[model samples]
Target: MEFSWLNWLYTAIAQVITWIHQAYSTFITPSSGLNWVLTIVTLTVLMRILIFPLFLKQMRSSKKMQELAPKVQELRKRYKDDKQRLNQEVMALYQGAGANPLGGCLPILAQFPIFISMFTVLNAIADPKRVSVFGMPADVVASAREAHIFSAGISDHFFSTQSVTSKIIIGFFVATSSLTTFLTVRQSVTRSIEQMPDNPMAQQQKILMYISPLFAFFSLNFPLGLILYWVTTNLWTLGQQHWYYSRHPMPKFDERGRLIPVEPKPGLLAKLRKSEPAPAEEPPPAKPEPKVVRNQPTRQPRSKRTGSKKS
Candidate 1:
């Protein structure tokens, strides 16, 4: 691939490392392995800090996307038969919420150029035959090549058949780097599951968990300086995420990836309702009948009967 466009990245990395080493040289040896190793670690921290805003945006976007998953699923069902239309609607939903399915990947993708450039620059530092146009002049290059973070050369690899002591030093960097990478990815995955188990990105994140740490172990043959940078980067990521998530906690989700709907809290009306029983309805009483009137015919009957007999 044509990476000429990435020359600027290499230059920036080289210059930063050069500046850091010069700054440290006031108190530390110019050729001290600790100086170069510390410079590399500092570079990782500086890069991460510069990109911290992007990291925050990426995280916020991921959260928003998860919250919008219900609507996204609705759109999918509505336009299941129309693939293109479904895509349009999904994107519309994302844009409406200022979220994107790929938003979480933006910061990572942005770092790729720097990552590649660091690899090249580290390799160049070990090779005296190469010339650098960046801040790394001949003398600086020589000092870096001769520097050692302990017994391991900044450019040495474990696979080069170096001595046992060198292997032990390189092995420490490799192990620390890989372990931190795993922890960082694991933290992300765990957070994702808690916040949005149904998030479409969660599955992709799981795959990255495996791929990221494995890639670290796979770099057993890579230069010690790059591995040192890797270790620092992971450490920064872990702390960065921990600090962010602590302040901006998200809602919990069920196993089905559904938000555990918060039960409405008791209010005045609800409290009164619980305290008082409902009034029971009653039926109206029936009306009474009037008394009947009767004549004194009872007494007249006897007398009338006598009179009629006489007539």
Candidate 2:
């Protein structure tokens, strides 16, 4: 079942990519490497737009996790000796609050298949014999093979190509991608620490802050087109996160990881919520009437006035 779903996903992604390439080919010179480059960037934009709701969910989940940090810390300290109990309590807390500790990872994980499919498509495009998709034409395939950036083929990798041009293009992609990733991670961690200085997750964030760039560098051998795709997406994430943080700063925390009691300024979403009217609550159902008693006794006036007059 999973394989079937994944196959469907890849097929769908291939269709979208091919459609975009064809659209670009209509007006742009297909022979120009710049045309393919622009197509990849445009594809990234469309994908981001589609997955934006996932991003919003991630943001909300992250904020919820942040809000629960203090409780998590308390759990850690309280159950420091019993690791099992600590784990149980943490899970319980997350579940009770309807939060997923891994919620923020949803968007990234969802994009994984799309990324792989794009890579596959680009690889196929580079090979003249294998460059056939449902709607892509022979002319587009020929054009893709001719597409070159800085004299390096769009699908060329550092290890596969002998040209200095390939090396330079790959190097530029690696450097920019790594740099942007580092900046994004650093900015995120710094803000998180500001909101909760004592955040128990600080250590994990610290590790990621250093390791993310390393991961980016490791992708140096990926196709120039894919690297370009990554660079564009990373740049988008960098800007989107910055905008989000500016509007909705994380809750501030003190040196000890305790939440500072300052009133939080509303974020973009919060402002929208504040502006909208609340839903009207439904009225409670009316209570049933009590049953009447059967055959109840009736009262009568006394006849003592005639006896007093006779006396």
Candidate 3:
């Protein structure tokens, strides 16, 4: 290939892979299988860390949207059949509430390029034509290529092998990836519904949630590396969803279509009330009185009585 921009991109990705290999070699034992396993795990962790701030922003934006859903639906109902008015009302509502429906999506959209780059790097590293690292031979490289983070024989069919084992491995990965994606999408939609107002819009969202996963399943079969990426992303999303929902329970909505803070449960309040009252503050102890000398007063009294008797 000519040394074009694309070629440089590939070279840069290869360099990343090489750097990962070197990093693992230094910190991890030189065991053949262990090295590759650590590489994948380490890469996943690094990516997640890099995107942590975005993940947090996504979570906050999602919570804001959920809090705004009831008001949004009210606006939709108020502007029924008037598309322009409906959008205007929606935008106004978002603005007044200091929330944006599109903001939650920005972080996810931003991750696409990085995801593509990582996918390219992983695919390049697994290519049979790529050079082996650290004086490793072609056979060792081929063996490493054959091994997957999940299964050793999984790459056979996709890598052009015709063995029955290859078919089994490929089938497993495809099925596993699809299944994880489905579950992830299902959980997300369910959470949305739980947070949504009871209305036609909620029903529409529910339908889309179900439909989107089917689309995602068919679209993820380009490369085993991409499949891995999808699986990891889905798994990370699932964990994040669980953490978010648990920590931030859905807010209660009032008749005015505004979110209200959920009051502590009465049972919890009763328990809190039952706890012992704070101890009454004790008064500080009084200081003891000093001893008095009565002999000086007795002498003065005796001297005055003697002077009176003499007069």
lDDT (Cα, tens digit) per residue for candidate 1, span 1-311: 32677778788888888899899988999898888877888888888888988998988898787677667667877998998999888888889899876777877887777788888887777666776545577778888888987788888878873589989988888889888999999998888777666667788888998888777877687888888888888888898888777656675466565776554445556779988977776767767777777665555665576776533
Give the residue spans of candidate 3 off by over 4 A.
Answer: 1-13, 27-31, 130-159, 198-204, 211-221, 256-258, 263-311
> How many clashing residue pairs, candidate 2?
3
**Candidate number that wins on TM-score, 1 or 2:** 2
**Model 1 poorest 10 in a row by lDDT:** 260-269
Model 2 agreement with the true structure over 65-155: per-residue lDDT tens digits: 7778888889989999999999999999988887786876887987787788777766767665675643456677677778898898888
Residue 71 alpha-carbon offset, candidate 1, angstroms: 2.8
Candidate 1, which segments miss by more than 4 Å at Cα? 1-5, 76-86, 131-135, 199-207, 252-311
Check candidate 1 and list the clashing pairs.
33-148
- Candidates 2 and 3, the one with greater lDDT: 2
- Estimate, for each residue in 1-311, the C-alpha lDDT of model 3 and write its tens digit: 22345555545544554567667768754435467555555666666777878777766777787887887787878888998999898888777777766765765786675566655554544566676533344444564565554444312335454555545665566677677777777776777777764745777776776676566555334455455556676787777767666667778778887778875434445668878597899999988888885665444665576777543
| TM-score of candidate 3 to 2 decimals | 0.68
Which 10 residues in a row give candidate 2 its minimum summed lDDT?
301-310
TM-score for all models, in order of appearance: 0.73, 0.74, 0.68
Once fitted onto the true fold, the runs of candidate 2 whose alpha carbons sit more than 4 angstroms away are 1-7, 131-135, 199-201, 253-311
The per-prediction CA RMSD against the true structure, in angstroms, equals 17.3, 14.0, 7.2
